[model samples]
Target: MARDYDSQLLESVAVRRRRMRDALLFGAQRARRSTDERLGKVFAGIAIAAVLCAGCVGWSFLQATLAQQKQQQQQQYGTPSAQPSSASSASTSR
Candidate 1:
């Protein structure tokens, strides 16, 4: 009878150990999944920021080019000689 009891006790301990190991493995897998999800979100945010920065740089360059074109146009067509007689006389008075 004592031997049977010892055997039953050993079996129960083994079962408990197996359950503990499974729980530990499941917890580790869950942690890994969570970490992967967070990393994906972080990389996505970084990509968006990079794209926005590029867009802003492009817009600034476009604005500068437009301004330069406007200045060139003014110099070409809107010179002092192109002014009306009244406006030029007013400027000389000033």
Candidate 2:
């Protein structure tokens, strides 16, 4: 029995062409489905979470500082609000 060399060669060449076409169609968009890609995504999510947490903490600290300053200002100028100054009363009488 004689093997058909031409048919085998044509089959192999067709397989190669099919693979090349498939690669061209699908391989360019997602070349490597790597574990590192997943790991990098997780690390990026963690980094974003850390940044958001830091921002919240900084915002709370800023609000606390502003409240403290407001309290200090209120203490400094509160006496005039509680009771009218005598000099203003005297000037009003005149």
Candidate 3:
């Protein structure tokens, strides 16, 4: 009878050990899933911010180029009226 009791006790202990291992594995899997979700969100936010920054830089460059073109056009076309007066004054003086 004593031998039978010892064998039953050993079986119960083995079952308990297996249950504990299963619980630990389940908890570890849940933790890994949560960590992966958090990392994915962080990377997505970084990608969005990078794209916005690039767009802003491109817009700034486009504005600067347009302003330069406008200035060149004004210099070329806006000075013609003044040149005729200057030439007439010089001819009168001569």
The prediction achieving the highest lDDT against the true structure is 3
Say which prediction, candidate 1 or candidate 3, comes out ahead on lDDT. Answer: 3
RMSD of each: 11.2, 9.4, 11.3
Backbone clash total for model 2 is: 0
Q: How much is the lDDT of residue 67 in candidate 3? A: 100
User: Candidate 2 has which clashing residue pairs, if any?
Assistant: none
The lDDT of each candidate is 0.88, 0.84, 0.91
Positional deviation of residue 59's Cα in model 1 after best superposition, in angstroms = 0.7
lDDT of 2 by residue, 31-75 (tens): 464455778899999999999999999999999999999999999
**All candidates in order of lDDT, best leading:** 3, 1, 2
What is candidate 2's CA lDDT for residue 47? 100
Which candidate, 2 or 3, has the higher lDDT? 3
Q: Which stretches of candidate 2 lie over 4 Å from their true place?
A: 1-33, 80-94
**Per-candidate TM-score against the hidden true structure:** 0.54, 0.53, 0.54
Residue 55, model 3: lDDT of: 100
Candidate 1 Cα deviation (angstroms), residue 52: 0.8
Considering summed lDDT, which 10 consecutive residues are worst modelled in model 3?
22-31
